[model samples]
Target: MRTAYSVETVRAAERSLMARLAEGALMQRAAAGLAAACAQLLRRVYGSRLVLLVGSGDNGGDALYAGARLARRGAGVTAVLLAPERTHQGGLAALRGAGGTVVPGGPESVGAAEEAIRRADLVVDGIVGIGGKGGLRPDAARLAALVGQSRAAVVAVDLPSGVEADTGEVLGPAVRADLTVTFGTHKPALLIDPAREYAGSVRLVDIGLELPGQAELEALQHADVAALLPLPQAESDKYRRGVVGIAAGSARYPGAAVLAVSGALRGGAGAVRYVGPAGEAVIARFPETLVSDTGPAKAGRVQAWVVGPGVGDDAATVAEVLGADVPVLVDADGLRLADRDTVRGRGAPTVMTPHAGEAAALLGVSREEVEGARLAAVRELAARYRATVLLKGSTTLVADAGGGPVLVNATGTPWLATAGSGDVLSGLSGSLLASGLSARDAAGAAAYLHGLAGRYAADGAPAGAHDVANAVPEAWRDVRG
Candidate 1:
C-alpha cells in the first residue's frame, strides 16, 4: 500500500532525522533529489534556460541549491528571490558560485523575473512551502499567473504551493505543476483531490526520515488488494461461496435494481438474492439472480444485505434490512430513509456509501462543504453513524469507525460519472461484505476493484454502468496476476 502522512507527522520525522545528521545533510539530500528530477524532465539540461521562483522557506533553499547544480552542468540558471533578505544565504552563495544569476522579485520590481519566466525552458515553483497556509500572497499570485501563461513545463518543490498539505484544500491561487518532487513522505495534498489535481504527477524522494505510527491515509496497491480478495476452495458451493441480498429498486426505478444486480454477479458472489418491486425487471436482465417480491428478512439465507439504490421512500424495507443480524451495506435512497440511530446501534458491521451530495445531506451541510473537506467529512460520518463510510468521487475514500488509517482509491477515470455508477459500487461492496471481509476492507477493496473496472470499461471513451459491471472480471484478473 502507498502511504501518506499528515503535515505534523512529517515535521516530527524531519526533526528526528535532522537531529542525528549534520546541519546541511538533510537539505542536501532534498536538493540532490530535486535537481535530479528536474534534469530528467529537461532531458538536455545543458544550455537550457531555467527559472527558479525562490521564496523565504526551505522549499526556496531546495530550489536554490538545485539551481546551483544545474548551473554547474552548464545550464543558464536564474533564481528570482521573492524574499531576498529571508532567503537561504548559504544556498544563494552556492548558486552564485556555480554561475547562476539572481534577480530581485520584491513588490516594487518584477519585470526582470517575469521576463525570465516567460523565456525559460523550465520553471521551478518554490514560492510557498508545505507550512504555507491559505493562499498565495499578492506578489506570489502575480508570478503564478506568469507561469500559467508561459509554455514552460513547471516543477513544484515538495508540493504544489498554496494548498493545505493536510486537508487537501486549495483555497486560492496555487501553482499547477507538471511534476512535484516531494521529500521524506507523501503528504495528503498529493493524494487527495482538488489539491491532488494541482500536483499533476508526484515523485517521492527518500530523505531517510523514520515516521512513527500508522499512516493517516493509504492507497491500496495491487498486492495489498490481491491479498484481501477472497478465493473459493474445492469444497465451496453457491452457499459456501457466499450469497448477497440486494434489497434495491422500486416500481418507478427498476433499472437501479438491474444495474445493482449486474455488479453483484461479477463481484465474486456465488448467488445474488434480489428482493423488491423490480423483481421482474431484474429477472428479465439477470436470469441468474434469485428474485423475490418479499422483504430483505424473507430473502432467505443471505450472508450480507445491500439496501438502497432505487428503493425510493421504501423506509420499511430499509428498516428491515438494517435489523438483520448479518453485515449490511446501505446506499442511495437508503442513505435517506435509514434511521441514523438504527445504523449506529447495529450489532453487525454497516457500510454506508455516499457521494459528496448525499454525505452533505446526511451531515446537514452543503455539497460544497463536504467536497471541500472530504477527509474530515468522511471521518465524521463514520463516527456519527458508527459504521464504515465510503465517500465516492474523483478519489474514493474509505474510513472505518473510530480511528486508524483511511483507504484511498484513485484508479477511476472521469467516465465513471454515469448514471447508476454508485449503485454498481454499492452492490459490489455488498458482495465483498458477504464474502466475509471487514467493513473497512470490503469497502476499500471494492473501491479498488470498481475503479479498475471503470478504467477497463472506459479505456478512453465514455462507458455506461453496465459496461463497468461487465469489466469486473478483468479487474479481478489484473489484481490476481
Candidate 2:
C-alpha cells in the first residue's frame, strides 16, 4: 500500500532525522534527488533553458541548490527570486558560484522573468511550502500566471504552491505542475482533490525521514489488493462461499436491478438473491439471479445486502434491508431514505456510497462544498453515520468509521461518468462484504477493481454499466497476476 502523511507528521519526522545528521546534510540530500529528477525529465541537460521560481523558505533553497547542480551540467539556469532579501543565502551563493543567472522578482523586473519564462524548457515551482495555507501571494500569483501561459514543463518541489498539505484544499491561485518531485513521503494534497488536480503527476524522492508505522492516508496498489482478494477454497460450496442479497430497483427503474445483479455475479459471490418490484425485468436479463418480488424478509438468508440504486420512494424496503443482521451498502435514493440513528444502531457493519450530490444532501451542504473538500466530507460522513463511507467521483475515496487511513483510488477514466455506474459499484461492494471482507476493505478493494474494470470496459471509448460489470473478472485476474 502507498501511504501519505500529514504536514505536521512529516515535519516531526524531518526534525527527528535532521537531529542525527550534520548541518545542511538533509537539504543537500533533497537537492541531489530533485536535480536528478529534473535532469531525467529534461533528457538532454546541456544548453537547456531552466527557470526556478524561488520564494523565501526551504522550498526556495531546494530549488536553488537543484538549479546549481543543473548549471554545473551546462544547463543555462535563471533563478526568479520572489523574496530577494529573505532568500536562502547558502543556496543563492551556491547558484551564483555555479554560473546561474538571478532575476529580481519586482514590478520593474517582471519583464525580465517573463522573457526567461518564454524561452525556458522547464519551470521549477518553489513558491510556497507545505505550511502555506491559502493561495499564493500577489507577486507569486503573477509569476504563476505567467508560467501557466508559457509552454514550459513545470515541476514543483515538495507540495505544490497554494495547496493545503494536510486537508488537500486549494483556496485560490496555485501553481499547476506537470510533475511534482515530493521528498520523503506523500502528502494528503498529492492524493486528494481538488489539490490533486493541481498536482498533475507525482514522483516521490525518498530522503530518509523515519515516519510512524501508520499513515494518514493510503492508496492500495495491485499487490495489496491481490492479497486481500477472496478466492474459492476446494471445500467451498455456493452457500459456503457466501450469498449476496440485493434490495434495489423499482417498477420505473428496472434496469438498475439488472445492472446490480450483473455486478454481483461478476464480483466473486456464489449466488445473488435480488428482491425488488422489478423481478421479471431482472430475470429476463440475468437468468442466473434468484429474483423475488417479495421483500427482503422472505428472501431466505444472505450474508450481505446492497440497498438503494433505483428504489425511488421505497423507504420501507430500505428500512427492511437495514434491519437485517448483515453488512449493508446504501446508495442512491437509499442515502436519502435511511435514518441516521437507525443506521448507527445497526449491529453489523454498514457501508454508505454517495456521489457528491447525495453526500451534500446528507451533510446539509452544497454539492460544490463536498467536491471542493472531499477528504473532509468523506471523513465527516464516516464519523456521523459510524459506518464506512465511499464517496465516488473522478477519484474514489473510502473512509473507515474509526478513521485510520482513508483509501484513495485514481484508476478509472473520465468516461466512467456514465449512468448506472454507482448501481454496479453498489453490488460489487456488497458482494465483497458477503465474501467476508470488512466494510473498509470491501469498499476500498471494490473501488480499486471497479475503477480498473471501468478502464477495461471503456478502453478509451464510452461503455455502459453492463460493460463494466463484464470486465470485473479481467480486473481480478490482472490484479492477482
Candidate 3:
C-alpha cells in the first residue's frame, strides 16, 4: 500500500532524523536526489538552461544547492531569489562558487524572472514547501503563471507550491509540475485531490526519516488487494462461504436487478438471494440467482443485504432491509428512503455508497461543494450516518466512522460513469461484506476491484455497465495472481 502522512508527521520525522545527522548532511542528500532527477529529465545537462525559483526556506536551499550541482556539470543555472536577505546564505555562496547567476525577485525583477522562465529549458519550483498555507504570494503567483505559459518542463520541490499538504485543497494559485520530487515520505496532497492533479507525477526520495503511527490516507496496491481477497477452501460449502441478499430493482427498471445480480455472481459470494419486483428479469439474466417476489424479510437467511439500486418508490423495502440484523449496503434511492435514526440504531454494520450529487443531497449542500472538498464530505457523511461511506467519482474514497486512514481507489477510467455502474458496485461490496470482511475492508476491496474491472472493460474504448460487471472475474483473477 502507498501511504500518505500529514505535514506535521513529516516535519516531526525530519526533525528526528536531522538531530542525528550532521548539520548539512540531510540537505546534501536531498539536493543530490533532486539534481539527479533533474539531470535525468534534461538528458544532456551540459549547456542546459536551468531556472530555479528560490524562496526563503529549506525548500529554496534545496533548489539552490541542486542548481550549484548542475552548474558544476557545465549547465548554465540561474536562481531567482524571492527573499534575498533571508535566503540560505551557505547555499547562495555555493551557487555563486559553481558559476550560477543570482537575480533579485520582486516588482523590479519580475520581468527578468519571466524572461529567464520563458528562455529556460527547465524550471525548478521551490517557491513554497509543504509548510505553506492558503495560496501563493504575489511574487510567486506571477512566476507560477509564467511557468504555465512556458514550454519548459517544471519540477516542484517537495510538493506543488500553494496547495494544502494535508487536505489536498487548492486554495489559490499553485504550481503545476510535470513531476514532483518529494523527500522522506509522501504528503497527503501528492496522493489525494485537487492538489494531486497539480502534482503530475510524483517521485519519492528517501532521506532516511522514520515515520511512526498510522497514515492519514492509503492506496491499496496489488499485494494488499490480493491478501484481502476471499478465496474458497477445499472443504468449503455454499452456506459456509456466505450468502448475499439483494433487495433491488422495481417494475419500472428491471435492468437494475439484472446488473446487480450480474455483479453479485462474481463477487466471491457462495450464493445470491435476490428479492423484489424484478425477480423474473434477474432470473432471466442470471439463472443461478435464488429469486423471490416477496420482501427482504421473506428472503432466505443471508449474511448481508444490498438495498436500493432501482427501487424508485419502494421506500418500504428499504425500511424492511434496514430492520434486518445483517450487514446492509444502501445506495441510490435507498439513501433517500432509509431513516437516519434507524440506520444509526442498527447494531450490524452499514455501508453507504453515494456519488457527489447524492452525497450533496444528504449533506444539504450543492454538488459543487461536495466535489470541491470530497475528503471532508466523505468523512462527514461517514460520521453523521455512523457507517462506512464509499464516495464514488474519478477517484473513489472509502471512509469508516471509526476514524482511521481513508482508502483511496486510484484504478478507474472516465468510462465508468455509466448508468447502472453503481448498482454493480453496491452488489459487489455487499457480497464481500457477506463473505466475512469488515465494512471498511469490503468497501475498499470492492472499489479496488470495481475500478480494475472498469479499466479492463474500457481499455480506452466505451464500455457499458454490464461490461464492467462481466469483467469482475478477470479483475479477481488479476488481483489473486
Per-candidate RMSD, Å? 0.9, 0.8, 1.3
Q: In candidate 1, list every pair of residues with a backbone clash.
A: none
The clash count of every prediction, one per candidate, is: 0, 0, 0
Over the stretch 1-481, how does candidate 1's per-residue lDDT look in tens digits?
A: 8899988899999999999999989999999999999999999998999999999999999999999999999899999989999999999999999999999987666789888998999999998988989989888889989999999999999999998998888888999999999998899989998899999899999999899988999999999999999999999898887999999998899989999898888777789999999999999999999998767777799999999999999999999999999999999999999999999999999999999999999999999998888899999999999999999999999999977999999999899999998889989999988988888999999999999999999999999999999999999999999
Model 3: per-residue lDDT, tens digit, 366-450?
A: 9988877888999999999999999999888899988999999878888999999999999999999999999999999999999
Query: How much lDDT does each candidate structure score?
Result: 0.93, 0.93, 0.92
lDDT of 2 by residue, 168-253 (tens): 88999999999999999999999998999899889999899989867989999999999888999999998888899999999899
For candidate 1, the 10 contiguous residues with the lowest summed lDDT are 105-114
List pairs with backbone clashes in candidate 2: none
Ranking, TM-score, top scorer first: 2, 1, 3
- The TM-score measured for candidate 3 stands at 0.97
